[model samples]
Target: MSSDESQQRRGSYVPIDFTPEVSKQCLKQVEFYFSEFNFPYDKFLRMTAEKNDGWVPIGTIATFNRMKKFRPVEKVVEALRTSKILAVSEDGENVKRIEPLDLEGTKNARHERNKRTVAVMNFPHENVTNMTELQEKMEEFFGKLAQINQVRLRRERGRKFNGTVIVEFKDLPECEKFLKTYSGEDAETLSFEGRKLDVFTKKQFDLQREATRGKNFSGSGQKARSFTGHRKNMPQQEQKDENKEEQKEETSKEEETKVEDKD
Candidate 1:
């Protein structure tokens, strides 16, 4: 093979995926540094590649070294220095901020503090007419539960006084333990707005959404109303029967009018 062809064959290589252009740029900067300092090209390439994350290509180093022959070594060094490839200080003492943590005697601090909490029982049957009544009931119910922390009452628009009370606990673990012990059992029976209080956790409330999927409907099943399975165009059986009855009534009235005219 010809020398040029052999060199081309040797240079033909796979491209590195990570910041290939940056690697080439860095290699060029390193070549400039070595030429300015009169260091060996082979040693510089090896050291630079080894210090980097193993993604620098051999062809890049060779090309950078070849370019240094035409480029002024001083100008190359100045460009390399400005390019941020080489350290400004050899000892790297100026870059002492990049050091491992000295967590030998450090204590891990808690992100959250624990406190007493109350679980407000939701009663669907209660005729809660207003916020005042709802808040009163919550206060009364939470008073009965032991280790009651703080209760905040909240109401949503269009909802008739039915809302949630957020209870903060001294610790999350305490609240979790309380939920575990009294989750399924009746903790306290309190009468609020003429309804019985039902205690539950926030976790249980979230789980209920998955449990009742596809079962909820818009109207009662007694009437032919638009709901889960029925489409708007496809009227229910009851609606069809109602329409037929109305048509029969209209036809009878028309026949009666015709007989009266004939008589």
Candidate 2:
């Protein structure tokens, strides 16, 4: 394309000031956004990857509402360069996982993730404008309190932030430490943004949710089954191997039709 054409294409783009802090946050957000734990239920990203053999354009990733603030597309691509889980394309225009996603493995991942996660509620939802912002704000808040892996904001059917979040820590010890210090008797006095907080272990959260919604509340697990091929529980060894082969074949087909985006 001509220089004028290229300039016109990017005319509407407004770049943000990139700094070390912005870079760190960008990498953290993108890494978790594509991590095995979040990818399965990430419908939009899954769709985009399916179109290009798991390779998603950096431009596309930068378009995400949360990532938009980390602007100048080059900065987004640069931050991903050091990622241990993501790999940039040879042409440096797109990015994908370093290895094909192990769909079956996500079952065990979710189990492990739950082991070190805690549910934090009553966050003053009216202050949360979007899920991305909520994740950022919560991550910052929780990071100061403990070593954390990710903070997922629970949302309602209409995509409204419900003032509840499930926070996963880097390890069981950190998780337990946070819970022991903040929950039970201490929870009464602990407040966030001036509002009292409700903290619960994963088990407690599930029980409370079930109690309020009745015994049939399956949560997002049931919803995630579609992407996971309904393997809610572990499968036989032979079946698992067979599914891996099938997944490989599907990925191969997607790669065969890979199309590079001009933008």
lDDT of 2: 0.65
* Deviating ranges (above 4 Å) for candidate 1: 1-119, 124-126, 154-157, 173-181, 185-196, 210-263
List model 1 lDDT by residue over 27-54, tens digit each: 4535433331122212333355356532
**Tens-digit lDDT string for candidate 2 (123-193):** 77765555555556677898999998767666554455666677889999999888888876544355787
How much is the lDDT of residue 146 in candidate 1? 40
lDDT of each: 0.37, 0.65
lDDT of 1: 0.37
Give the residue spans of candidate 2 off by over 4 A: 1-11, 17-21, 82-84, 186-188, 214-263
